[model samples]
Target chain A: MEDRFEISLLLDFYGNLLTPKQKTIMELYYNEDLSLGEIAEINDTSRQAIHDLTKRCYKLLLNYEEKLSLLSKYNIREEKYKIALEDIKDRFKLSDEAINYINKLFEDINNS
Target chain B: MEDRFEISLLLDFYGNLLTPKQKTIMELYYNEDLSLGEIAEINDTSRQAIHDLTKRCYKLLLNYEEKLSLLSKYNIREEKYKIALEDIKDRFKLSDEAINYINKLFEDINNS
Candidate 1:
């Protein structure tokens, strides 16, 4: 729950790997921030079942992250881009417009 | 079989997600280019079992790739870097040494 944003990010990377049910439940609980009882009621399942499904989804997401490290790789790539941009700015003495454009591009990438 | 290199690259991204047995089979078949019969004999399994395991591994790897698209993302990133490098080279007029260093870095990334 504390790492809800991180979990959502992981879901972005590996959500398609999940079953439809798992993906739906994840969207309900994490994206919609639904209570277990609310989700269970909506899905016509017991609260306990909803809880269990959520736990399984968490475990599965963690497992995928652990194995693939796509999230980590992404963070690393972002960091590298930042460093490269800085290097270019310093070494090449890029113009303000050029730096601004580069910053905008990086912002678009990070948003995406 | 035809996309052996592609399969190997997929395995690189998601190999650790597989069961140890699956990883071993993939390493034997893809990395070592071992025959199915040879792998079966060494692993004390039938050729059919080896064949089935490999097929499952392929399916699982493909599933991961389809879901995560990390391989595709990596390709896109590399392409972006190439374009960015070219843009910088043309606009900033970086030194030949800088261009060579950047090319070497990209080569390292591609090899990795």
Candidate 2:
């Protein structure tokens, strides 16, 4: 089965908005690595129905992500964290003042 | 009038969710620096009503912010941007590889 990583990320972010049935179908299809035929049989439905529902669920999740952009914002934050951590860890041995300045910058951000 | 910067930021973020009249009142009170009396007279309402309504709108916006957290996420993103720019510009005399790496990190974030 193909690895549907993007949809998995979207699911993690917006899965709560999906109906339980739709969400289950998605989890089975993407997360559980179940074939659509197996999922349909488990749900006592046709393979075609599972296929369509999964597609619709994917679109719905995408729509939610597009409007709110919570996923994109989250990814950006992660990137920033990774970059800052790597930079401070690997390079730029600095004085106590510079270290404190960096620490204070993040402290103020967290407080805000 | 004492500066109410926080409400102004909240209004910018969650203002669209508010009722039209509520939005107008908030904008007038915070953006236009109008007194409650001035706003009440303009709307042909009691000053006390305007005062209470503005207070209510403030709480409503706060609730929206608390639940969605769009504002806090935005602040964190801004802090990251400011730090990255300051890091690249004010401090780090970087090699081409380091500059390219940082640029790629942000570009990937923007693309995502």
Candidate 3:
């Protein structure tokens, strides 16, 4: 996967692990399309505090992603699976015998 | 945005909103690079339960994304901000006066 996609996935996963306040602020700012000032007013926090929290949360998320690489590994495995599936489909189209063999093979694989 | 990118973002966001057990299964299967049997062994759950939970979580996440579109909206906004930043950077090298004006403008924008 591309670095940007990896970063986005990491951020999404890390964001879920944050505290409710942090999650709410992130959701309001990034997901809810709220301005900093608007979020500060609604949450009854100072604008500077909100900004600081947002910055800190972003840094934390990036750090977690760098250390764990969870999302990157997941993407790689997923890509591998997709390629395997496509290859099987291609083989299936080449011969009816291949199709039945592949189907049975997949069932066996799943059962095992 | 491309459909694949949108779908991936939606899945990531929706995954965040899932129950801890569902999230744990997803992380194990997708992020931890574990097989269903391996995950079942580690979680001390039946293989069928793990399989069922994983399938259910995937469908639930997709449905939530379809209903909310939170991640898609966030991605669009992020793209707009990135484009704006790039445009400002491009303008910066064209003229020193423009550079200073844009820098000041950005400061004002941030301050506001």
Candidate 4:
């Protein structure tokens, strides 16, 4: 299963693990879609600091992900569960047994 | 705000960005707290795949975080906002100005 969430979600999950400075730079660049020069001007920091911070923050996020793999798993499960639920809901001809099974499956998912 | 959420949260958010095999290995190792050998046994994959998967997943997560940063910001803002709301609610002697200010703050937070 080559399941992968969007890059934006990944950024949202790991950005806080960075330093405040790094976080700011990342937000400015990624979320705000600001240029490096614009971020530098806004923070009154050098463009170099912004660049270095972005690089270091990226490295930190990678390191953290390596040690812990929860974000990725959560994303995959959430997507799968959502799609499953939607598909079940969309099926108009689901029998009572199918409905019961789907309910049980959802319960198991919630419990997990 | 260096308001980082738990590592588990980060893992949950970023884990889905990996392959299904990688995501499974991660869930077994991190969420299930299983040993590498155990994960290997369960998945019928090599211990080396488990190790390498973990390593690569981590790197992918980090790279994703570097490029985008919503998770980090969301966590910090959520923490700060929760604390602020709790504190305001707990304060028994808040003036009308304070109440109005807090209400406005919460409104802004929700809108954001």
Q: Each model's interface RMSD (Å)?
A: 3.5, 7.0, 21.2, 15.7
Clashes (candidate 1): 0
Q: Which candidate is the best by lDDT?
A: 1
True-vs-predicted CA distance for residue A62, candidate 1, Å: 1.1
lDDT of 3 at A11: 53
| Second chain TM-score for model 3 | 0.64
Give the TM-scores of the predictions, in the order they appear. Answer: 0.83, 0.47, 0.38, 0.38
Candidate 3 lDDT by residue in tens digits, B1-112: 2244443444566655677777877777776668999999988989999989877777776665554444554455345434544554463333545335434433332222
lDDT of 3 by residue, A1-112 (tens): 2243443455566665577788788777766668999999998989999989878877777765565444554455345434544554463333545335434433332222
Q: Which ten residues in a row are the worst by lDDT in model 4 chain B?
A: B1-10
Model 4 achieves a DockQ score of 0.03
lDDT of 4 by residue, A55-84 (tens): 676666666666555466555545555554
The segments of candidate 2 whose C-alpha lies over 4 angstroms from its true place after superposition are A1-3, A89-112, B1-112
Model 3 residue B107 CA deviation (Å) reads 52
Write candidate 1's Cα lDDT for B22-88 as tens digits. 9989988998999999999999989999999989899998987887776887787667767766875
Top model by TM-score, which number?
Answer: 1
Candidate 1 vs candidate 3: the DockQ winner is 1
**Shift in Å, residue B27, candidate 4:** 0.9
Docking class of 3: incorrect
Model 4 segments more than 4 A misplaced: A1-112, B1-7, B86-112
Tens-digit per-residue lDDT, A1-112, candidate 2: 4349989988876776677788888998888999999999999989999999998999888887776666776666566745664575466454555555555554444333
lDDT of each: 0.79, 0.73, 0.59, 0.60
> Which candidate comes out best when scored by DockQ?
1
Q: Which stretches in model 1 have alpha-carbon errors above 4 Å?
A: A104-112, B102-112
